[model samples]
Target: MAGNKQPVSVLVLLYTAQGRVLLIERADKPGFWQSVTGSKEGQEALLATAWRELGEETGFAAAQGVLHDWAQSSVYEIYPHWRHRYPEGVTHNTEHVFAFELSEESTPRLNAREHTAYVWLDWQEAAQRVFSPSNAVAIRELGRRLSPLS
Candidate 1:
């Protein structure tokens, strides 16, 4: 699969203790908002994928804050328009989930090539704004995870 992408991906929910989650508008799909996400490169651990995507998409480093592996994965059908990036027969993707907490509210350095704009919204609003069901679920989960502590 010379030009094929790995079916494994990572979804990083970037949030603050106050439950504000960061979402980026995709350059490819202007209205589509999502958390930090990207496919895994050959042999890379899912955690590494999450860290790489976080930096690549938001210019945020895992070392700068708390990055937690939520130990969750979701299998979903690949979007038809984006399926061409994967092997011809690959129709599904497994996305691992991670949660990153910033020390406080901070602006994300958006990657213009992948994302055109960024916004920080309340976790509930962020969940509603995301285009992917899985991404939305992760945002809501982040809220649940923080509720007890808040």
Candidate 2:
């Protein structure tokens, strides 16, 4: 119906040269962890959405990090609990993946109503720690790209 969200979203994973990935705890879901993610507002471009969400969710400065577009996308079913945020009959979401390379691990000012805490862990650990399968896969993919063996 009207006043519902589009099913397009962005997932921005922040990582460092040391392969540490940042994971944030959701304020609403306590233990549920994820990278910075949010839906595209109206007709916003994907890059704009990425930057908007990064700043909105983590208080990260737009000019502070190197942002990379993984040129990857995933379509997954929206969790039942969050379906209400989208329009009627919208069961799936198309998430574009990106990564921000930080020079080093840094603390983020979490949005109190969106996220409560943050942790920086090894890429593998972060992949396993995130609540969404797609997010996990993206982190693992980042690991593979950053790994010497890959």
Candidate 3:
């Protein structure tokens, strides 16, 4: 826990049944917005990491709504500035994807330390607003999943 950040993480996309998606602006990076995301700690399961991040970032627990494990993961290079959080040789992260769908639109009680603002937008708009490509892809997939027809 002290030497390096885990290379594994979870990315959670919070959305409504009607396809509205939530995005949070990073406190440290201002305009850099994304869905719920954090690295796994200890031996935590990916599902647990998803729920923990969801609660930490949005104050929403898995029991409050439906949490779907998309069973998908992405590997990407860690940004340079954030690399110090990880081990010296760690240049990439593997992010598991999850989806939380609320019955309706609702406000999120954000963690001020991690995020400064939050927004709920149409899936398309949410996808466009996110600074992370993986977050955008998850949003678009949410849109496709909630569409009238597959």
Candidate 4:
């Protein structure tokens, strides 16, 4: 029997206090860059999914810095090519957003199977560089959070 499809996932925006965001090029898809993302395994909490994905994908653990749940979500259709990962008839996924703010830029150990390389860029460039719409939305939201309130 196929496992239950997890509708919840996490999209973690890793950034520096200076407002630089980290983006990784996907190994499976050349030129496609994105932040850390993954679905919850079993019954893990949403935040746990974020932390686990961050550590798994980038070697950055949220325990060392500020990890804020933006309390935002986006539901979108799962791409046709990658739909096999989910159970049958699972066509959509809801991604919860989180941000990990570091004091300075740090080296990230990329999982070669998942990513080719990683780069840190200013929020604007990062937003434009990411391929996924939900990731771009998270980056824009991060910009808003970091902006001054006047």
Best by lDDT: 2
Q: What lDDT tens digits, residue by residue, belong to model 4 across residues 1-150?
A: 334668679999999877899999999999999999999999889999998999999888756688989898999998888887788888899999999998888889899999999999999899999989999988987888788781
| Candidate 1: worst-modelled 10 consecutive residues by lDDT | 1-10
lDDT of 2 by residue, 1-150 (tens): 333998999999999988999999999898999999999998999999999999999888767789999889999999988888888888999999999999999889888999999999999999999999999999999998899788
How many residue pairs of model 3 clash at the backbone? Answer: 0
Model 1 off-target regions past 4 Å? Answer: none
Q: Can you give the lDDT of residue 101 in candidate 3?
A: 87
Model 1, TM vs. native: 0.95
lDDT per residue for candidate 1 within 1-150, as digits (tens), equals 324799999999989999999899999998999999999999988888988999999889856789999999999999989988998889999999999999887888887999999999999999999999999999888888888865
Q: Candidate 4 at residue 54, lDDT?
A: 90
lDDT of 1 at 43: 95
Provide the global lDDT of candidate 3 against the true structure.
0.90
Model 2 score (lDDT): 0.93
lDDT at residue 3 of model 2 (Cα atoms): 37
lDDT of 1 at 24: 94
Candidate that scores best on TM-score: 2
Winner by TM-score between candidate 4 and candidate 1: 1
- Report lDDT per candidate: 0.91, 0.93, 0.90, 0.89
Clashes of 4: 0
